[model samples]
Target: MKLIDTKNQLNDKEKHIGKVVGVDNATLTNIQLKAGEEIAEHDSKNEAIIIVRKGKVRFTVEGKPVEVTPEHILHMTPLEKHSLHAIDDTDLVLVQVKP
Candidate 1:
């Protein structure tokens, strides 16, 4: 069992996008992007959900472009190819569930 204050972790330092923070049965990742910053295309072996914490981002999911704002929650199934770009300064959290 584990409990964490993810916000506290954020306050400790600013992170680059797609940084894996913690992992057990799942992965906890912290993503922060400056305007024009991007994470290149990649596929995940596990299912993932990306929570937009601040600003806006562009997601390319399976070759489709998706605009994601702080109000949206993005889900990616296992083995899905995805990439991200910041439309503005952004903060996001990626939670990946592993098998």
Candidate 2:
């Protein structure tokens, strides 16, 4: 198993406001998000899970908005369009299953 510390991942300035911790089988991935930043709207044909680690985020699934906190885990089914915005400085782990 590959071990990763999401916080230790390098931030790519040209990319979005988050870093990819680990990816395998092109299915599962760990992501980290910063404050005032966002993961733009996108869609996938597989299910996904978002686990909040350190802060708040405004997450939208299929156009419905929901607030995700450290105590919450967000899950999305196949083909659902979704996006996330950091409400404050935050950290999140996104696990996506490929179709």
Candidate 2 Cα outliers beyond 4 Å, as residue runs: 8-26
lDDT of prediction 2: 0.71
lDDT of 2 by residue, 22-90 (tens): 355445455555677788899887688888777799988888999999888888888888888887767
TM-score of 1: 0.80
Candidate 1 clashing pairs, residues 3+ apart or interchain: none
- For model 2, the run of ten residues with the poorest summed lDDT: 8-17
Q: State the displacement of the C-alpha of residue 34, model 2, in Å, after optimal TM-score superposition.
A: 2.4
Residue 4's lDDT within candidate 1 is 49
**Which residue ranges in model 1 land beyond 4 Å of their true spot?**
1-23
In candidate 2, position 84 carries an lDDT of 82
- Poorest stretch of ten by lDDT in candidate 1: 6-15
